[model samples]
Target chain A: DQQVKQNSPSLSVQEGRISILNCDYTNSMFDYFLWYKKYPAEGPTFLISISSIKDKNEDGRFTVFLNKSAKHLSLHIVPSQPGDSAVYFCAADTTMGNQFYFGTGTSLTVIP
Target chain B: EPEVTQTPSHQVTQMGQEVILRCVPISNHLYFYWYRQILGQKVEFLVSFYNNEISEKSEIFDDQFSVERPDGSNFTLKIRSTKLEDSAMYFCASSERPRYASTFRTDTQYFGPGTRLTVL
Candidate 1:
């Protein structure tokens, strides 16, 4: 069962533009959401995360927004750079367990 | 910054042979986890280890699969009989604490570079 879904298979944006990647989850029990950036042949690196209690969390150029009502969360990269080009995976976890459900991932290509 | 590390960046073995993937999680981390991703698929959780015992596991973590913290620094995943379908990238991760704790809010999981297991 695919609890998390990232409908967008790939995304392209010009450098220095805003890049928005979206994700949706079917399980309401997911109280924590995180975004990870991965490069070829490498493991995913934690980018940002947002708690269910908070609507948004920001770290430098990255920001994560969560809409509990819609069971959706988004990762926003401001002034997207070439270094930001990679596969982005959105993950969710419930408080009852530590297992994380990951989305199919969205490949972001920030054109330089 | 200290990071998780996995041995044998790539492993290739016969379908019926046994394979072991090793990992060294962050020293101070209390929780350890194993995850895998089939080519072109989303990452899936296999199991979680805590205090030298398995705290949770996914259905995919069948009887063929097992995890152990054999030593203070080494965590291993062993597949008794590897199947062709078992070929995938296996990742080792660790967290200082669970995402949710009684007093704390959240702690992010650190993942290793991953071991690409190829069962021919």
Candidate 2:
């Protein structure tokens, strides 16, 4: 019953490089997708989100790309820094539903 | 800078005991939700409340679980006669708009630092 999935459990990137985390969903009913960054012992912080109608959305150094056809979405961080290291969770919601479905999460480590 | 907040950062209770987890959502937010994640599992939705009533709930939220906005600013989740399998990190979240709102911009959610419930 895993509607959303993050195949990669962990990823590492060098400082000033690009770090990409990917997520996939099986439910076509999900009309919105979002990415959240979570630090150890803290709550998840909303990073960015994209509507199913759009393919890409960018905010500062973070960008999210959505491919409805593939039912895939990704979060990309440019010029990665140590502060960017954290577990990233991908969540999706249906237009008619209030609950969000979340992935297991992908841990990203940006080495300085 | 208003944010969701939860009490009893960690609660250790024995099986068959009732435990109440509390939360205070942002003042102006209109929606409140509860979610949990067992160690090593994905975050799972428990219930969503609006207008003082539950809008939706998952299969995991059974007869033993209930949510209430006891007051304007406080939201609570109560688990009756807890089971060992109920051990998990419970989170409270708030959103400014409902998913069906015409202006919905993904209805961004603000989450509180979770409460770790350990049932022995």
Model 1 misplacement above 4 A: B102-106
List the lowest-lDDT window of 10 residues for candidate 1 chain B. B99-108
Give per-residue CA lDDT, model 2, range B24-105, as digits (tens).
9989898999999998889999999999899999999999999999888999999999999999999999998887784655
Candidate 2 lands at a TM-score of 0.98
- Tens digits of per-residue lDDT for model 1 on A39-67? 99899998888879999998898999999
Candidate 2 residue pairs in clash (backbone atoms < 3 Å): none
Report candidate 2's interface RMSD in Å. 0.7
User: Any runs in candidate 2 off by more than 4 Å, and if so which?
Assistant: none
DockQ of 1: 0.85
In terms of TM-score, the best-performing candidate is 2
- Each prediction's RMSD to truth: 1.2, 1.0
What is the TM-score of model 2 when looking only at chain B? Answer: 0.96
TM-score to true structure, per model: 0.97, 0.98
- Model 2 achieves a DockQ score of 0.91
